[model samples]
Target: QQQVKQSPQSLIVQKGGISIINCAYENTAFDYFPWYQQFPGKGPALLIAIRPDVSEKKEGRFTISFNKSAKQFSLHIMDSQPGDSATYFCAASQQTSNYQLIWGAGTKLIIKP
Candidate 1:
């Protein structure tokens, strides 16, 4: 019930196109959902997030669409760029577990120039 499943293990997008990555979880106890972006040889960094109460959250070119009832969420990258090429991970955390994040397998995105 604590697992987050991600899809499209790898994606290729033309520059200026949109890149979308999806994830699903089975744990209703999860209260915090955050997406992380990681570059090679570096730790992941918070990209965007949404609470169970929020349907959507956007930051710059990144947007997260959440469906609390469906236990699903997706990340959309607007105007994808080569610089945006990286691995993305979706994670969930609950207040009861000391806020430990249960992670989704990484999605590797490549923006073709």
Candidate 2:
């Protein structure tokens, strides 16, 4: 889908806890999925992604669980740390397209001490 909608607009988790964020899309043509993590004064970097072809993808403490039939996906942060607190964005796009990402409104994650 062309639109990726994310929720909880903001999240607060204690250090060493698990943080979860969810997203949904309307279009199924979108073939590429990526999550970007952004910190203050810095550009978002590709955190991790999963295509419709895969059910889940994980990178270290970050995991992306996707549901193609439901047109939804979620990000799970394990052992969240204060340093992990940042704005996370869920994105989707078609590989055939020019790589224009349809982004979520942005979820601000804050880990409390």
- Tell me which residue pairs clash in candidate 2: 1-27
- Candidate 2 Cα misplacement greater than 4 A, ranges: none
lDDT of each residue in 1-113, candidate 1, tens digit only:
87999998999999999999999999899999999999999999999889999899999999999998889999999999999999999999999999999999999999999
Q: Kindly give the stretch of ten consecutive residues in candidate 1 with the minimal lDDT sum.
A: 46-55
lDDT of 2 by residue, 5-62 (tens): 9997999999999999999999888988899999999999999988899999999999
Backbone clashes, each candidate = 0, 1
Q: Model 2 residue 17 lDDT?
A: 99
User: What lDDT does each candidate get?
Assistant: 0.96, 0.93
Task: Report the number of the highest-TM-score candidate.
Answer: 1
User: Could you tell me how far off, in angstroms, the CA of residue 33 lies in candidate 2 after the best superposition?
Assistant: 0.7
